[model samples]
Target: MAETSRGIGGLAFDASKRARPPELNVLIALIAIVAAFELLGRLLIGDSFLFNTRDNVDGIFNQQRLEIIILQVSIVGIIAIGVTQVIISGGIDLSSGSVVGATAMISMSFAQVALVNGQPNPKGVFLEQGWVDLPVIVPVLVGLACGLVAGLINGALVAYTKIPPFIATLGMMVTARGVARWWSKGQPISFPTESFAAIGKGLMPVVIFVTLAVLFMVILRYTRYGKYCYAIGSNEQAARISGINVEHHKILVYSIAGVLAAVAALVLSSKNLTAQAGMGVMYELDAIAMAVIGGTSLSGGRGSIVGTMLGALIFGVIISGFTFLRIDAYYQEMIKGVIIVAAVVLDVYRQRVRSRG
Candidate 1:
């Protein structure tokens, strides 16, 4: 039937339209930068920058450097996945890093082992309450609970109370950090159970990050929540007019972001085998940078989890490249700032292109 044929054709066009602005741009950028670094490596030291030519490490690539880059990016990338959703929904979360710190301190309290090296845990602050050496699930649950509560509070302020997201999350950032420090009078918590430590050991962090990214990517592309998120971000008033529950949706978004931050904390504290008040310093910034660089619009309504993943890789490579070149840490920070601004500018330009097109 001609009518059926036309309908099928229309559907195909719609699908393609939705997937417009492929990740080719970001992917190309990634490849180009890696090439630049490779060229630089040859010029600077006559060594391979992206490949392993030495006997100290395994694989054709520099396995040690590769692992370091992946492990470091994986932790922050987890947080970025949640932040990507928040930004896509036309909101921002400034409290993720503090949430990570707070969640780490709180959860590790429950994860502490009864004995450390055959001795009672010297660092167990909750031993007096018999909270030591709990099952691995206990600490994980505690961390998620902390995140849920923080998210609820943030949602209440931004949704029902109509407070600005920036201010509400900012207030939470300070409050959460203070709670982290006050949890045990500024003492670091250590001596976690073997099971808890195993969660982030070796390449596990990268595995977790990649898994979560894939799951969320599917959610964003195929679910009602994803559609509503984009609708709200594209135009809140329009979404509300169409009967979407804007306030409740925002609450859910912030809450999910909180949970991801907590998850990041669990992995981070596990990797370090300690929970300190100073953990996750500036993590929120790094997560935001990852999302922004991956081509997520701060203004909202346009982004993909895949793009964020690539952005995270770019971030890791740049950091690793800088270290490879022996660039100063402080200078790296400055360059990072510039790159963030450039990404946002590019985002704006893309938006203009869409509007004009």
Candidate 2:
């Protein structure tokens, strides 16, 4: 009886020592941000941040504002999903925004409707019209392939040649942007087929983002692939010694990131009905900020899909709140930069506390 009691006590003590999941902290931050906005709205404008004040609405919650917030963040959130994985695998992808630009141009060309209002597509990339109005799958596949190829190149460079991820992805960024410009000679590609356009219509982007987030969350938490990523990020030498294919896994991680970026491009272009050379400018930074704000350790070996989703929500809320307060765009940008830095600083502090513990 004495021995059993001691054992039980020890187990209880161990359990008590365990730290809470990081997502809880992020969730709290999100709630706090929302509350802050709500308070500010009431004090400053005699309005509500998330409640419907207009007489036209029957519900208390502002459904339109909620939808707008989610829709605005959904595309960039998709890119952040991939960025989360890459960062967890101990790498960065600076080329995702460029990949979006390039993929948008390339894929939209294939998805162009042969005729607009019974006339040839005025903004078509191909003059022959043969390349236009191909099946939706064709453009999707083409877009995915473009991303895959770019990702493969990024992976190969980092894994085989030992190029730093920053430099490699940066180079790819420039190259991919150039491709975006060159694809249509700096012209915009517009007028996609009905099927292609349907991909991003209404709440479709949110649906897609949520689907991918849930799927990858499962993959990262339960699969060997996820274990390898964590192991590699935690300690590359240890992972290599444990018989993991570090190079191959790194390549795979970056490749998936590229594909996700392409997915964002496809959705964005489809929704906007046009693909521009400058589409996705600074999106990489936004994706990275989302990941980092989600409690993803920039140092790697730590992060989650759930956290990223919550982070994206936080981002969306801040942006919406600012606009509600009528903040200037430049001031918003400056504040965003500060928030990003603060998140990174907090991450570093967390790492330190964990090490000490």
Candidate 3:
């Protein structure tokens, strides 16, 4: 190999290339997309899509729409943070969405208030039973425990049993969703304590998402765990030869992913004031999509939390833009699918270039 070329931990990288950084590229694409929407808005509705200089009163950024875009993606962005790590380790996790479903149901069952109207609660899933209203911490702990256990199971299966990541997580996905459905016998869990409800009220989800992203960004960029993940994804055989306990590292990574999913569930349930068996349907895919669009290589070994954040922003903007344009729900889904496929194709191409470089 030429001196100008070196491996990224283990994957290939060419310093000679002048290509724009992945995150920057995605940012540009997001701007282009927003501009397209704005143009369409002007042509179709004879009104501004993102600005309102017509009155010279509203802010130029369409403050309400900006808030909507950020808030809409924050819950799922938390999940994407975890998913980004998993994919960076060259592993796939299909169980996260289901983990959210399961965690939500289990935690809410504990968090439910025993009283309504200053009386024994009716519609109380736990009040009529021996399980009375527990403190908010109890439910939060329960949720975290549920997520940790589920993640540990995934790690064990993949690390010890040597099962393929896809198959293992897929099995978990089905099982966890089943658990969610069975938790309250198909009933929705609601009426959480005031403390619990406050966890994700209003702008709280965005706060939690941003804080976690910053924390993990630091960890991923500055920690041994980050290096180990890149090493494993880049080349497992070489990582093992270099004294990395590949199995333990994998378990740790998966466990982290699980806990993050649980946190997302907590925030989501708190925001909605309820938890349902179907709460997180297709969420795993959305999280994965964010990672991919953010320039996380699907083949693994290369990604960034910043890129995923931008990807999430793009996701929020696109979805909200579609709604702003009055696009139908079904059509929106189709377009999203196309975008995901395109992202994967682009990733594959990037991998090929790196391999050749």
Query: By lDDT, who's the top model here?
Result: 2
Worst 10 residues of 3 by lDDT: 1-10
**Candidate 1 regions with alpha-carbon error over 4 angstroms:** 1-22, 55-58
On lDDT, the stronger of 2 and 3 is: 2
Give the Å error, residue 143, model 2: 0.4
Which portions of model 2 miss their true places by more than 4 Å?
1-16
Per-residue lDDT of candidate 2, residues 1-357 (tens digit): 646545464653355546788899999999999999999999999999999999987898999989988899999999999999999989999999999999999999999988889998899777584888788999999999999999999999999999789999999999999999998899999999999999999999999999999999999999999998899888989999999999999999999999999999999999998999999999999999999999899999999999999999999999999999888878889999999999999999988987896
Q: Considering every candidate listed, which one attains the maximal TM-score?
A: 2
Q: Give the TM-score of candidate 3.
A: 0.93
Candidate 1 per-residue lDDT over residues 1-357, each given as its tens digit: 646545464643344444356367888888998889889989997888789998876789877887887888999999999999999999889999999999999999999999877888999888889988788999999999999999888877888888778899999999999999999999999999999999889999999999999999999999999998899999999999999999999999999999999999999999999999988889999999899999889998988899999899889989988888888999989999999999999889877886885
Candidate 3's residue-wise lDDT over 55-135, tens digit each?
656666777788889999998999999989999998999999999999999998888888878977555776656575677
Candidate 3 stretches with Cα past 4 Å from truth are: 1-15, 53-58, 128-130
Predictions in order: lDDT:
0.90, 0.93, 0.90
Estimated TM-score for each candidate = 0.93, 0.96, 0.93
Residue pairs of candidate 1 with colliding backbone atoms: none
